[model samples]
Target: MNMRRNDVNDLQVKVIPSTINPSSAELKCQSSCRLPDRSSFIWYKNGQKIQDETSSTYEGNFSPADSSSCALKGFEHHPAPSVCVHGQSCNRVIYTDRSICASRGSSVDISCTYSSDESITSSFWFSPDRSHQWQNPSQPEDLSKDSQYAGRVQLLETEKGRSTLRISDLRESDSAQYHFTFKTQSFEWRSSLPGTTLTVTALQVQVIPITVHQSHMEAELKCLSSCSPAGRISYVWFKNGQKMMKEETSLYSGQFNPGDNISCALKGHEDYRSPSVYAPKLPSVSVSPSAEIIEGSSVNLTCSSDANPAANYTWYKENEDSPKASGQIFTITDVRPEHSGNYYCEAQNKIGSHNSTLHLIVVTDPGTAITIAAGVTAAVLLLIIILSVFLWMRKKRASNQSSEAEERPDNRERTQPEQDNLHYASVQFSNNQADPLYSNIRSDQLHRHMEEQEVIEYAAVNFNRAGTAPRTRGQETGEDPSALYSTVNKTL
Candidate 1:
């Protein structure tokens, strides 16, 4: 009896955000009439039954574009209207979604609140796009009455001041800057202030290539609209045309098989999905030089794969426990006999992984090596002999130059004309001990020698003391003024 009554009515769902401005939520579905203990409930988003959501309670981050409702499991036919996901009811001309992206050929709702101090005489939405086309450009016209928007525009005043502008059969030409204007008796809210923008676009799935240090590499895909605003948008992803697990807001990030196809739709417009982007093709490995690798030469191994998201590359040698290298090009600077091996490169992305192998053989010839070594050794020996000989000759030349320099003075001495025979003369100093040379002061022998050598030179003396009349030097000496000293008679 309770089950029947509950079925006649409808299930009530409460949607609450975790914060005032929310990106996450908590939801509960309840039935007024008591049903069986085993009674189950299902979740619905935007009037569509959410796959695999059969719990009475829901906890997650949901798209702001979505509205949510709930239903009893067996009576899915009579669920109540979905309440908007947002709990925001802010005053003023605050738009619930400042930027809205909708699929072409679909419908979208842009909501805002316009309140005023004076009584609102008139309230409506206008597009700058249609205003430019009007005969009078200064005065904006209502979008619903415009011929271009005929039969496709709706204005619903949800409450006293809240309003929603719903546009159906969205076309790319319908993309425009939308504004809400409200007029009071004294003033009009001008369109100069920026308003909400609506973008009508077809969804596109794009692969965003990334280089992650992790070994278990996963490619990241992003859902994009052409010329879209730069921010995170909620999305629904599909793999092989099947809805991905629980329909996450973020696209799938994991390994995928070769035949698998990936596609995505904007979260609110899940019915209009983009074309599928396929996974990686078989990887191809190629070696540089296209000839046998030579000893002591560089070798390059390149790997490539065709995929929606470009593939990351890792290189491995056949017997190595760890990856030998990473990147599309793996280079061995100096290939040697020990480097000969079977190597392979694996190309991977979120979609899948594929690899191709290459064989390398480092060629070495023992006879050629020995011959080259012998030639190098012989050349080095010859160079050493030549250097030694050159150094020895240089040393001999230096010795000769030194000997010539030393003997040059002696040779000049032998070549010089003879000087006059030098006289043998000696000046004797007395042992008076107290300035004996000045006391006795006689050099007859030196005088005689000077006479014979005809080389006489003399020094002068000053006998005048301070404060005395300057004496003529010869006056005290009683000798020629040219004479340095005559005799010093001490107390005689």
Candidate 2:
């Protein structure tokens, strides 16, 4: 049976007696693994077999073109990768990863590998100052001794040609180019050319306005960081605490309502999430008295909406283009009939805007209304007065007739002998001679007696036409009617 050597383990070579001076530098190759006593070794330089001597070590003078590695005699297929010394001191340092990005308040590790022809005594990592050189330090200063990196920086590991520097609680000031340095017995070395660059950043969300209408608004949101992160990165979207279906894209677009909260983050970096942004929603309008909107009354209309940032309010009429009022509460003092119409309010924010509608109705004032009522009442009163007067006149006439009937004698009384009828009878009276009855009477008494005699004659004629008994000359002579007739004839 054949036995296979453990070729998978790494192999290293170092120079003995150090290369301090190029002119007298003698390089000897030695391996880290232990071989059997007196075992022979194979040596190669830059992938070409240079010696196959039956010794465990190779000795030669250092040369600028020489790079060396070794393997067990028969296991040459697993020879170590090449290593070379460039400077006279044969001291060199290198970083495997040249650049890195880390979130603020996070931890990071910078790895490097270095080699030297002499034994390493010290190793540390540092950032250069404005002079592009290492700052002043104490005799044995390392990264942990620096005031700026005191407790936050540490050397995690160090092996032959390998070192790792760890930094925690990263801040933006930590972003800079870093170089690794180490000291051997006689030489100090620092990595040259490209060094590890760190970028410390915090996530931020940017909201871009697209379009806005009365009902809704459209906007685009993007996840942003200070510098691009290393490796594959994915984005996550959230709305009102709920995860959204959209992923893998930095740009997001949708209609937003007022008070809607939106946020984004990297899939693996939820701790450094962007701040929440609130989108504007449509407005709602309400009136003090929703129904029976009246004119000539004080009224108030309120507009409200939810949004990330507080919203501005503007009130407008149906036909007007310019806003009539501005604020959450729109007030109309002493409203008029013309104020009754369709009205709407606009609520706006940086992200979006919306509008709501309301209707108003105005009525007549109390003073004018009372005037109309008084006019109607006066017309009714005037009609009542006129009707009352007409009724009073008709009643007065009836009363006068009743009084006349009571004063006049009935037909039976007229026909009785106690009542005497006076009539104006024609009697011959010469101007030269007066009657004896008139000769004794005064002129005033004669005039009054003639008036009385005429009224009696009218009464007798009315009675005679009303079917009462008429008196003959003989019957009237018995009651002295001849005397009254003679007296009336004398007056005529």
The whole-model lDDT of each prediction reads 0.68, 0.66
Q: What's the distance in Å from true for residue 385, model 2?
A: 60
Q: Per-residue lDDT tens digits of candidate 2, residues 348-450?
A: 7767677889888665766565666678889999999999999999999999999888867775576554236454332333234332223233356655765
**Model 1 Cα RMSD, 1 decimal:** 20.3
Model 1: how far is 393 from its true place, Å? 78
Minimal lDDT window, size 10, model 1: 483-492
Give the CA lDDT, 0 to 100, for residue 490 in model 2. 48
The alpha-carbon deviation from the true structure for residue 239 of candidate 1, after best TM-score superposition, in angstroms, is: 5.4
Off by over 4 Å in 2: 1-89, 97-99, 105-108, 129-141, 144-159, 190-194, 208-215, 218-220, 234-255, 279-350, 353-492
> What's each prediction's clash count?
2, 14
The residue-by-residue lDDT of candidate 1 on 1-492, one tens digit each, is 446734425456687678744778888887666666666777765434564435678877776445566666676544543466664321135456545766765677888766554587988898876776877898878888889889999999879888899998788888887878777787576534346678788767776545433343346777666745335666789988887866556455665446678888766667778777775678888899766467888988999888766778899999898999999999999788999889999887655677889998777875665676679899999999999999999999999999999999998786452234343322223333323133233378765655765653433233434455544434546766333343421111
